[model samples]
Target: MADNAPAPPPLYDNTPTISEKEDPSALPPELAGPCSDQAQVTEEEGVASDIADKEELPLPPDPVETVTVTVMESQLLQKELPAQENPVAVEAEEPKLGEETELKQKQKLGQALQSLKEESNNVSDLTESDQKALLELKQLIEEALNEFSFSSPPEKEKNLAGTLAVEVSIWGIPLLKDDRSDVILLKFLRARDFKVKDAFTMFKNTSHWRKSFGIDLLIDEDLGDDLEKVVFMHEHDKEGHPVCYNVYGEFQNKELYEKTFGDDEKRAKFLRWRVQFLEKSIRKLDFSPGGVNTIFQVSDLKNSPGLGKHELRQATKQSLQVLQDNYPEFVAKQVFINVPWWYLAFYSVISPFLTQRTRSKFVFASPARSAETLFKYIPPERVPVQYGGLSVDPCDCNPEFTISDPATDMTIKPGTKQIVEIIIYEKCIIVWELRVVGWEVTCGAEFVPSTEGGYTVIINKAKKMTPADEPVVHGSFAVSELGKLLLTVDNPTLKKKKLLYRFKVKPLGD
Candidate 1:
């Protein structure tokens, strides 16, 4: 470490874990995330499953493949045949509920959302009514704090050796007297329609649950290391909310499924790991009234297991119950990618029953539309490569550029050619990283001089690249003369392809 360099943020010693830029690894902020996510596509919504290394499923099966969720689980799990018979999910139009179930589902869904407020960023801009509710809730919490009604967090010795704290806090903000406390309270209020008594009760329960669950100590516990890829906090979305990706498809593997849900003990451990990851991720939020106090949740369901896994289904129910009861409105939006056709049908039916604001927070994308749907809210470079983007996990590695190196993507029409040009005015070496997702095209590069009659130099000869080639192309060229670099892509196939590239000019040797 450099003598004058800022030390890595303290490892949550005296303070509660908190940071808008928290490192993804368990280590301090100086070190970042895991090498690779070990994630794969989820194809179960009605699309075909990866029958390729199909091992006999360890758990027994039920008659039908059903994807069902109570109001508490990731909304995407609500897709009610869930079979892949129609395969219309690949079409542009989404499915509405079955005619028979539409009206009935609507009323039930309405009841589910009847009390919750619409999703809003304007917690600071409260109405007179909202203000009154906020004040009432604060008083309730203050009184509880005064009386020490909430139990103290358990397992204090596990925390960094420090003095005990008298004040109770969630996500590091004190229950009273802190501006950010209002934001935390508002989440509970909005989750329960600003009903003070219900919000207060919910708050008490959360505090009690945290102590009983040993959340403070869980942060320091080493759950299954393999679970890291199942859910992880990575880069932020365009709006600055940290992005957490849930790849439940990992559970499809027999060994992993057994390890996570094989017995009651393993299931208990899995639940702890799930909650611990959420706590770690939540601590990274900025809870100030005006800060981004929420996260963007992306759950990839391509190969996610069906309901037949009774143990998993039961475990999921428990986890969702805990989240719905305690976590409240920390999720800004829940996006389910690679959704099967049935999920669309069910979501479309219930959407009308949800408040427009609440409905907006739930997004569903079919397999074909998954990558593009994610791109709408998260930049392609910030997206993981497994989902058809330029950003790689720490394992594949990005040597020439970091996330700060801006990159843009474009689509190439089938059977056409595209040329990209970059003008240079000084002596420098231009280095670039480029990738064509699922590439099967011919590409060439060259430089044209600015001076009249100056000769052009060919950088890379036009060569045919295939889907079997490396996912990204890294290149550089030295130019002592004023010139422009031209990179070309010729697509000979019938399908459109996405191209991403970025460059930076480096002066001659340091």
Candidate 2:
């Protein structure tokens, strides 16, 4: 009879996914795989090294104030890059040492771009095997595109191999456009550990899914604004990656829950909305090889509907499948804050769908540690006010300060009092904002003058602040004399509290 046709290429990775049945302890070491390869991980140790190098870079000190930098763990950190329309790995000129010494501060940012050039989109981030895989994947894609027409939309039915198609693009970048194509290609390669065949399959499948799902059209669709607060893109993480927060508790409202998941149609709409949000967010990222391409995902599970909520679970399952399939290597870290006891069950349900590398980026925290955990990855100033941070929404009426103001974060042990002293040597007015997450403590402020003759001013009388109190304290004082502002926090409960504050001193006559 005849030689059997060569085995058809697999449509998806047949590699067995990590199962809950498998040992779970081996995963979630906070992260073990983010920086292990070039395709992902710039937020942790690898990215930290970038920062460490900057910290070591000899630069002129600031004249106004010395900016304090916080470096958390050296482990891998993540923020997904957005698929930009014209993102490319730029070969920016490097700054010479001691060049523009006075403007050395500008060089810090330049060095960051230079470091990205060294770490990403170029051959430096790749191994011999990775290079080989990349070449193979590129060839396979050329063949597939020539053989199977793939475009953002307005699908072309003709599949001709006369040439490598430049018309086929993803995230608005062509398959053969430039180095950016390689950056996007590496994402698939790394997601499959540089398995050429698997990566090719993933590439094909992603294109196919985008078309089948009409993602291009979906992005422009208006699904409704009800879930606006449920999910949103906020500021960047410590590593400069964009942070996306998912407040699942917002669905706790019965009306919202029913509207989103009451029926199959509603659930489908929610999924579309979520994917739309993700597509929109991804477009905001820079896919330049060395750019922060991955997103930092923080899921707030506080007050999340429990396992009994069949619809929520089902929607989550579907969403996970879509994300895991089409959005490979898009997440830098998957953090679950204020995780409930049922979190294990939730993890178990989705565990089988994720890769070991993906799972390694996971971090979990209970309610008590939620805000603190975030503080490690995200600075207190960059975090949202509702999440125990100084960054207020633009719509809110905080005129004195914006998210740009840097804030100091510290902790006070139980049964102890910590005082923050801001010494003023000039005649100026000071505006300040402070907050203690879970305020089961007492807070007060006082002014002490350098001269013994200066009268002590009690700005805020020491009061026992409870969780019921407003989460933030804002105060302003007109300082005509040189003195020191002392803000004090006293914790009486057994639990420690996170303290965040920022202040600005306005020179007189300004």
Best by TM-score: 2
Cα-based lDDT at residue 433, candidate 1: 75
Model 1 regions more than 4 Å off: 1-124, 152-165, 451-456
Over 1-510, each residue of candidate 1 has an lDDT whose tens digit, in order, gives 000100111121111112222222322111101111111111112222233113322222213211111111212222321221221112242434643464565465455434332344454578888989989998888777655677444532223544334557787777776778888888788767788898899889989988888888899998758877777777888778888887766766789879888988987887777677777877878876668877777767555554456676556555555655777766655666765544444444544544544443555566655676676678777888787677886666767676655566666655667677776766777777777766777788899898999998989989888878887888898878777888788766655567777666666461
Ten residues in sequence with the least summed lDDT for candidate 2 = 1-10
Q: Clashing pairs in model 1?
A: 35-395, 42-302, 42-303, 43-302, 43-303, 45-340, 46-84
Candidate 1 has a TM-score of 0.71
Off by over 4 Å in 2: 1-121, 151-166, 341-356
TM-score of each: 0.71, 0.74
Scored by lDDT, the top model is 2
**Candidate 2 lDDT, tens digit per residue, 1-510?**
000100111111111222312233322211111111111222211111122112222223222211222112112111212322111122344665744662564466346334442235575668877888888888888776766546543454544865533477788777767888888888777677777898788778878899899987998898989988877778988777788786656766899889988998998897788777777877777887778877777766555444456676566556655665666666666565664433344455556665545445556666666787788778777788788777777887378776656666776655567777676666777778889998877789887777877789899999988878888899988877777788888766556678887777665566
lDDT to native, each model:
0.61, 0.62
